[model samples]
Target: MAEQCKISAAIVAEEKSCVLKLDGYSRAKGLLKNGEFIISALFNVGGHDWAVKYYPNGIKDHADSISLFLLLESAHAKDVKAKFKFNVLNKNGEPVSSYERSDWGSREFVKKADLEESAHLRDDCLTIRCDVTVIHGKEETRVPPSDLHRQLGDLLENKDAADLTFQVGGQSFSAHRCVLAARSSVFKAELLGAMKESSAGSIEICDMEADVFKSLLHFIYTDSVPLLEIASNKGETDVVMAGHLLVAADRYNIGRLKQICEEKLCTHIDSNMVATNLSLAEQHGFSRLKEACLQFLVSPSNLEAMMASDGYEHLKSSCPSVLKELIARILPAEYKAAKDIILAI
Candidate 1:
């Protein structure tokens, strides 16, 4: 084993504190209906991960109060040794209440009815300060980067001694069987599992377009989509190709690529393409994309012109369910019929 060296106390000790401000606290009122709303992410304090949890209207038995607690996220080899201080700040940036403990374990920091009053919960926002000092902890080893991923990407790009060839839309693309198998389970089953294609040297794919297949191959090699790969004089082609790529990705069980295409389609959606993209989203069962399309159509500014657009009929014919969702959003509950809602719009 390599010899270890220890630094002096002043240099060895590392303490971190953060002022967590929960803004728009009222906007998230519905979430508090279930239980406490914990801060979404972990915080680093004295080289240890910690979390702050908040109960907007307090825990079940403590409904009159707002509760806050400090949580030690990582499993302790022994009982974690630390000191903690919790402070609730008022709107003027002054602490209304403060609590401190030395050599403490995780526990509830505050439970107070004062938080419900305007002085503590000003403008529907709350701010808290947490300080932590770790008395004992071990350092974590840093991870080293592996060159295997880079080598595989380079090999795929150069078509270096490729072991398999894929014929997509009559276009031949060469890649390593192992690399494809590792990135996608669909490819894994086709090339390495008991499927008949495993024994074959060349595989044929007819459903996906040549350009979309190329994009899928690119994602398998690099874990990203190069949007400029199929740029054409008509800007509309990029959006259309991304939609096709998303479908191909779903077929191949490449979730990340599907998400990438969904986000790209969302950014490029407009009056001309919203209907087609919505239909694609509905067909693919992508809720985010479907929601985006509904939001665009429901907006008073976009609805009038979008209804008159050329693609609107295609959207209605293909994804009529989304039209119901639009109607629900725009019209009152009394107007139940789709025709009435359409006329109201």
Candidate 2:
């Protein structure tokens, strides 16, 4: 027998959508007569030009209704078949299925009287969404996922084209000044702006550990923190590392990383770590984290346990005002009044 081979092909439909928001619908109705239309701005979909025609008083025959039509505007385009749907959007900007119309070209979309009374028309405005799916008689090709971050991370790991070095906690770290400057305003000012470190070959970073700096560099290169991911599986270490990363992020003016660290610390609050987290929050003026810490301290048992924790004394000495705020948060009005009177005496 002869060997046989078969080829496979699949049809693909590329979909795109545009929304036409008709503001001042009542004004449009007053300005445009029946059969007259307002054409939407030309939009491109699947390599073909398209536009929507909105008739305020409807086309000639359907005078009582609002009309919508999707027109293929490419001048020389031929044999381009597409499926389209016109949807009347509700008050919350959601499509109402009852008002949906699917067609090849024109549609008398909604009755003007009905639409005027419905929630779909609000603030003298109405929104219509048109979805077009262009069919192609060819197989779709697979597109690979983006690896830009991976490539950048590889560059960092290989230390290729490094222009600056940081001496942090007695350890040396190589980095690209452009990359650091691009990621952080503080780094940008220090490395590129009129600062002393801008001209220095090696800069010393104080009050930050080498490991924390390493993790920060990873985030700068790859926009990720594998250290934080790994730390999440472990308990106390995760909270402690997140707190450290939060401070480092704030110092470097890395807003997203700081938010991520703050969120992580907020979720990981326990009696043992609450005092330390509270102190950090107070010093950094992190309102959300401070609120989370105070909420954790609302329980009498948690408060007692936090008072006996290792960080309690540090929290007291470093942020006495925060402790006073904590007392006000957990105390009743009458008791607070009594305490205030006693202090006055």
Candidate 3:
């Protein structure tokens, strides 16, 4: 005899709620007469359209009271069963009054005189919270996680339907022209615009390393960079790669990638990398990265170490004005410390 396993499931009700604030409540009462109503903006609950109808002065015979109703806005919906609650909220957003109903019905929620005397109405405004629970006869299936980026990454790795080639630092890379164009404005212009290289079979990229170009293509296809993960394990290589990739991202007009590189460099600031990062920030007009570098240099040891680093001479040569600005930034604190010492003496 073979053993058997059993599966079980239960019906679940989907619940969703929204808050509607009625500003200028006094003005609304003056403008909207008895039996006249204003409907809240349409909202979605349980994949169906719904809205709240507010009667400033009560409808029909309940003229002295305020009325509220929930409407099913889906045109073709029939016999849709739902349990809903209406609550009037106080200034602190706690419920002051609560009422529950099933299906659909209008309630003379509160008398106008009672509302005016109550704490729920304040500053000429009123807030209502609507809670909706849609009952379903059967359990809904769970949705699977998306693998779009993985599929695209696989396509890039396989070089499937690749239509363009780039030669960078003696290594060749193959890619789909449409994908590149879609991700980068510079690529769009170079590949589809009137540029001379648009017609070329294989274009040569100068001044960029093979690995940097490879990572750039990976981001273009998958919207991610494995270099960040590598940064956690192999520190200096990924940081250097990020600097080169920042330049490439700027060249290609890829805003998001440029931001990612800037953020990575900002977080990885050190004595050896500060001068180079400052130079890059100044050259690229990256205000946030420049600010981070300046903050890092505020420490005397960090500043001293940065000046002794290999890239300091390059920074001084390429950006003499920035060095002057740095001196100006440092002098005030030094002067304050000197003045404090004099007072102590």
Candidate 4:
């Protein structure tokens, strides 16, 4: 016989409740004389308007007593229902007595005699509390965002309906031309325009490695890349992949992919990678990434350490014009302050 197992689930609340309170009951008593009712300030509960009504002297048959009622202050196509709990707090700011209802409506909640007997009133003042949980009515069925992307990703993985093959670094990748053109402007022009590669069934990609091309194709299909966990030191490999992918994104004119790669590279910027990243940023005209790299290296704390990196020499050689600005920033404040004395020497 098979063993039995239990499965459980629950509806987690998506929104919070609204609490309504009424204070200064004593002073308002005299104003609410002659059985006149005083309504509390408007409060919102679950997108509907509501208020508390207090009758200083009881209405109708309860003339010798006070009455309290919770009212729906706004009109609705259907009744706005809620589960509520009412409380009369003591002078110590604790609930002396309470009433709970799973589904409360507009009705008299307390009578004067009951309030006086329970010692809920002090100095002719009383406190009223309402905790409301509005019924959301019904749950709507919907499709999750990941489903479509996952289906496209499945198609890519299966290489189903492949119409083009890309030969990158001795590796062949099968992909659909329609999908590629739809996702990238560069791909659209190369595959659809009067380009030599558009006439061929197979295209050759040089400079970019197979892994980087694969990652780019994965993003084009799935709208995401394989997880590159950034917490471990081994994640450095992933960061390097991101740098290469950033270049691919720029070449292909995939703005979103470029932004994603730039953000990932920014998170992993260090002494060793800053120079390379800055060079790539400058080459690709990535203003944000370039600014971030500059800001990271120009700080007095990191300036000297970053200068020692091997890539820094390459950066200086390739972009010597930027050195003047960097030199100005690297000069210590004290050096500038004592410049006159040095000049005298």
Candidate 5:
């Protein structure tokens, strides 16, 4: 049977607009970044000043747009530009600092920063905000589009304080409250400067390790670090080589090298990998390998399921306590729940 009923259709839409004041800007542009864009640019974003690089969407009516901010972290008089490169230029252009370049890899990062609740920070990065309508392909690409960058510049001109100081590799410097000129005396003195050699050894040949130091120096300067220098035609697992790799990674924020070490640690999470990654992870405590091991211990399944099964006995024999903890946690919660339900039934 079919029944007829009254029907009506209508489309009602309205355009939304807001003033691009500093507060409004902080609110809008804070939504754009995908977890720390070119951190080098972080010290320069935001202010009551001229326009900043923020994207306001018009396509899907506030669906998407890129926004960036400069965040500064300081501890006991040291500045850490806590921004990670998230934009295309640094992926294709020159990077400013290791910190700016230190997210490991671009595609692997997550977290579209929503600063609505945690917008306030004494050491927080600069904030940029924009609202883009969802329907436009890229509202920002349209030239002469309404924007606030000029306003950001104007505000920056009058501001007296920077976001914070910057510390990179191990050196430290003060961040300025300016538009970060494409070229600057400060950058020349800081970023493009040279390191003063302080080794007591002669510039002449010395020891086997000094040569490795020379390699580190070359890489920190040119970003062209040499591959693992196996002294012999044969390959050997030298802890010193891993140390140099870590040094190169620390100085340049080379994510591939870092991942290689991390995977090397995970693959051999054997006592050997544990011993090595423990030191490296302790040195760099913010790394995720710590969580990786923590999760691995409590993993619902065993690595045996995915790999060959010769080494479990060796692991059981070496670190029995750790092995027992791993086995206890790996047992599925479903197993216990099913056992309990069977008794109940």
Candidate 6:
């Protein structure tokens, strides 16, 4: 029972003829209705929750997550700023997370304790209220410095996570899981029921490095994931984080996160570690990773190109059979024969 928040949209073209696709139950006292979006604040009041708040018998006016993302992405690169923020709350009308307009801000994470505050206690619902801003029409908008879109585009274009176990600071990770989780929602929407329908129960991620796993968990809940780089010296620019994230993304069928991982991988294609991982990408059905692996294997010079490429370290220990199969797939049909001949000679 709060008043409507009458915040304004900066885009001049949207000043008129905009519909308030606003969900009445939204806690934001005033969520402005405009083109492609009705302004919503992340602060959730107890009354209206989005997770189960269904639209009246299917009126498709308010945008779905993909539509909003597309509308945002379609903005000219220079017009898009590198930052976004939201003000979120839980059921008890307490601060779940919030942010004001800033040049660069990521989605705030809600902790388990915060969940306790949810008025409705829906696992997927969060009390959210906040305005979004786009820096379009400027001489140059602040897009991320790294090329996330390109890496993902390469993988999707080719098909797959580009399967490489990203080792950052010496810790190994599964690239496939990361990409899938990141881009999962997109897949859920686009594929129209292809995602692995979660069983009518909960899921707990298996054994994972605690902090890294937590970071990934955050990514699962919120599409906005913070970038963490493991070994910049060896050219692992967020590969560990991005690689693991891709696997999670793929698992959840989130498309954008997968693309972000692929883009990150493409940025450092020349690095031996990346090439080796790309080789492993195929087993996971990461067509792009498979393709990258094929490209590197084509150049014997690249395979001969080893700078501490402990190629099979993680899998040989944990998944010997799977790794062996991958090796067989990677090597030529005559590779075993050639090895036997060399031993005899």
- Model number with the top lDDT: 2
Clashing pairs in 1: none
Model 3 poorest ten-residue lDDT run:
1-10
lDDT of 1 by residue, 1-345 (tens): 001111111121244566767766655544564354555357676666777666665666655555566678876635767667666665566654222222232233343432442346667666766667676656455574555544565687669889898899889999988888888999899999999999899988887888788878878887756443223224787788888988988998999988888888887778888888888888889899988888888788788778888888988898787777787778767666865656456
Give per-residue CA lDDT, model 6, range 5-75, as digits (tens).
Answer: 23232211222111112334344322322222233222211111111111211124322111121123232
lDDT of 3 at 171: 96
> How big is the positional error of residue 126 in model 5, measured in Å on the Cα after superposition?
57
Number of the predicted model whose TM-score against the real structure is largest: 2
Which tens-of-lDDT digit does each residue in 116-165 have in candidate 5?
Answer: 21222113332222211223232344455332432342243333454433
Off by over 4 Å in 1: 1-149, 228-234, 333-345
Q: What TM-score does structure 5 among the candidates reach?
A: 0.25
- What are the lDDT scores of the predictions, listed in order? 0.68, 0.81, 0.78, 0.67, 0.34, 0.41
Candidates 2 and 3 compared: the better one by TM-score is 2
Ranking by lDDT: 2, 3, 1, 4, 6, 5
- Tell me how far the alpha carbon of residue 56 in candidate 3 is from the true structure, in angstroms, after superposition: 73
Tell me each candidate's TM-score. Answer: 0.52, 0.58, 0.56, 0.55, 0.25, 0.35
Candidate 3 or 4, higher lDDT? 3
Candidate 6 ranges beyond 4 A from true positions: 1-203, 220-222, 229-234, 312-345
What candidate 5 gets wrong by more than 4 Å, as runs, is: 1-212, 221-240, 251-269, 291-345
Better of 1 and 5 by lDDT: 1
Model 1 root-mean-square deviation? 19.2
